[model samples]
Target: MGSLRESLNRFNKQQEKCQSTLTSIAASAAGSKASNRTTTTPAPRAVPASTLSKSPVPAVKFSNDTERLQHINNVRKSPVGAQIKKVIDLLFESRQSFTAEQINEACYVDVKGNKAVFESLAKNPKVNYDGKRFSYKSKHNVRDQKELLKLIRTFPEGIAVADLKDAYPTVMDDLQALKAGRQIWLLSNFDSQEEIAYPNDPRVPIKVDDELKQLFRSIELPRDMLDIERDLQKNGMKPATNTAKRRVMAQNGNILNKPKQKKKKKTEISKRTKLTNAHLPELFRNLNG
Candidate 1:
């Protein structure tokens, strides 16, 4: 009798499992039919980070003509010049320092976005990963220049000409020029105790806008192919459909600055109802009656 009871329990669990499998199949079939009947656009689905662990790419925007010319010169000077500039800009703008591999990953995104531009930068002697960090080893490294400027810009109690002399190689020339240009007094009374520091109309670092930053944090895009073709199309930045490559290159930055989708705030949604007061009499009156 005990064996018989055990056999019956096992049989009941198997039956329950079969019932659940059947129920799931029926629901799936019904869902398929519903999907076929629907024509409305569904809400966008977020891709899982596990499935798409790659960071979103963003097109880097040269903040001003000075930066643009600098980038152009970089491309002309070093094979890795463009990439070095890009990494420098990223480091300056970033809230934290990144590893060399991370920098390489970001620059390689350029390779994916623009083959020619990547090749040009790849030929640079100054840009190489030291198995740990990407270094711009130029005699006049922009990375060093920018770092020194950052220190100067954020110098507490302000920096003196003497203090800056060690950091800036051309300090004497810069001081003399400032004096000749009637700007010597700008740093003459430099304080070193105050929290806020602003030195002699120092070259302010370029700041990427919030929108651009969001894209960078989202997309992780590279410098040359600042604008991906797919993104450009969405922003209505299409060429004459058959425009020259040069023409496309000329308009690359313009297209990349295209607006991204703004996330709408979700309000509390109530359950949807098909019946209103007008239809209630015809639909519900019969049921009530």
Candidate 2:
């Protein structure tokens, strides 16, 4: 029992010495700083909520709608002014009511994505939109009142107000003004169901001007007109009346109302006259008083 106790005490003392040595080694290692030693501790680099909350916020970019509008305004004031004027003139001259899409088609513009041309057209005083469609005010009336009267006098077949309205919606107003002034007498077939007339119909006869007359006359009669009419009758091949008129004018510019060559009459010589040709000397003899 004495040996057993001595062994236990010795074991305890050895354990205590070992623990002390381990503690001393740990302290020495912590105190020592080597030139090439790497720290095992991880760095605390995450952004804290307090620092993030105080940082400046970035600015946002926005579209300049005013600048876009100003750009459109500038386009209106440019040389395109003449083009717009011409388009307006055509709407009246053709006596055709045009929708926004039609106007764009006439101008060779694509208004599906582009708004400038459409917005510009809306600015005209005569431009009125009936919810679904757009049309001009003075479609049927000639811009010059004198011209309108002259045309009516020349072709007394008289025009439908709707036809004129289609070309120039203000034609009725202009004609009314003329009536009020006692300048011209106009007739309407409006009440007659036999003559169908609509508000947007352009009723004026497509006039054959001297230039067009000359152009048509230069070509052989029924042939040229037939060819053109037949071509125009084709599906999807028909051009606007105004476009067709212009095309004809362009093609026949230099050619005027020159007459076509007629077939010559062939005369046959008489058998007796052929025999008389041989007896010409005998025919010269007798002179009677």
Candidate 3:
């Protein structure tokens, strides 16, 4: 029993020593002056949390958040938000992919505002972060004609020029190029006072000559104007306008009114015909008398 108690007392002493050593080590690691202190005890080596605290990470701190909010808001409203906003705005405005590093470099915001907003954007839901880059959702960078045409087609009513300007700064030039290529049409909307463009519809307009050919083939006689129009449409031929039908009818009328060639009178070919053929010799003698 005595040996047992002695062993237990030694174990308790060792445990207390270990705890004191650990406390000293934690304190030393937490502060810089700890390394200078002399110690009679050996400390166990382990990984530490202090190193993680020193990285140059962007952050916004709050003590009394209620009071800090106005300051934070001021920062956001003033330039921090604006700076970060410009980064995204330009990115969205440029309508292309941009990295956070690129934004950090190109931003022209004032130092204080620039600093706060740049860091805060990482958490902003309005900004799309793909680990390395940022982008605005509604606007996409269009680099070529095919992509531009595709975007216009996606919006049926028409994409507003104002909205497109945010994504495509030079939308007019692009639309003009598309128009010149015969890939789209630029239409003026008077009510809204907005000019819009749209891709060509799949339906093709039929030629007037083609329509005339088909109409004549299908009908042998004159038909009512309305009936002709309906039949032409029913036959999958588009005259394109009401005037086209009128022109066709006028042309057909000229054909029907053409003057007929007269036939030669049929009579016996005999002595009379022979005398007429020899008219000069016999008629000359009579004339002389």
Candidate 4:
């Protein structure tokens, strides 16, 4: 009975050890699973508040119909289209692609009414229209002085300033620098006052001979403007003003319309009455006789 009781105690002890070992193994497996979850799963990143929130665009306003029309005229004059010259200016200035609906929303124009303009833009070589949106395709990609200089050199006659403004926004500064450097010449049109740029050719230097230089130095201009004017008139030049013609006409009119003075009839009595002056009359009496 003593040995049996001792054997039962030993079996109870072995069972408790086995249970404890199983519990330890299960706990280790659970810990490993929790560790793997922590390592494998990615954490969520925080987004920028600025990127999430955008400011609303301001609405365009005009005081009157004339002001609104002037604004529209200015937009029409922008560098864009061949005929219409309106919608594509927005695309050019923004340098972004926009759909027909988007363009209408931005400009507040009746796209349906100006359907022909949009159709023309689609066919225009300077505009790039994909199946969805349209973008501005610049004719000249001049950004700096070097590119501008290269472009100016290409045209020997001259490039129009109006055309350059279309290519580069800050072309005026580049042109000014070029002019200061004596690398280009800016000439103004007589009637339009539009500037034309010509490249300065360093290869051809202005050369004057000694005789020509002396002739230029010895040139004597007439001080009398009347002589100069007469010579110019003789060479088939006409008077620019009517002042000279008016002066001559005024003088002639005064002479023709002037009043004439009547002469006194006292000369007939002088020869007969010459003897009545005593001594003074005697000296003149021989002449009177």
Highest lDDT among the candidates is held by which one? 4
TM for every model, in the order presented, reads 0.18, 0.24, 0.36, 0.40
Better of 1 and 2 by lDDT: 2
lDDT of 1 by residue, 90-199 (tens): 64445234464565465432433455644444555534444444444333322344454555555445555544543334644654554565432344342454222244
- Candidate number that wins on TM-score, 3 or 4: 4
Model 2 vs truth, CA RMSD: 22.7
Against the reference, the lDDT scores of all candidates come to: 0.54, 0.59, 0.66, 0.77
Give lDDT tens digits, candidate 2, residues 1-289. 9999999999999999999999999888877654225575567799889998896878998777887667555544555455456556656566567765676566534333445655666677666555555556654346655666554555455555455544444556766776666555555453563332222213553556899888978886345555666666775566434555767888999468989899898754444333445657565344232
TM-score-better candidate, 1 vs 4: 4
Ordered list by TM-score, greatest first: 4, 3, 2, 1
Model 1 gets an lDDT of 0.54
Better of 2 and 3 by lDDT: 3
Per-prediction tally of clashes = 14, 15, 2, 0
lDDT of 3 by residue, 116-180 (tens): 66567666755766777776754555656677888888877776665555445566688888888
Write down the lDDT that model 3 would get: 0.66
What candidate 3 gets wrong by more than 4 Å, as runs, is 1-77, 92-101, 108-127, 136-142, 154-157, 206-289
**Per-residue lDDT for 22 in model 2?**
100
Per-residue lDDT of model 4, residues 70-146, tens digit only: 76565544444443455667777877788877876676443434666767878887688897788887777877899
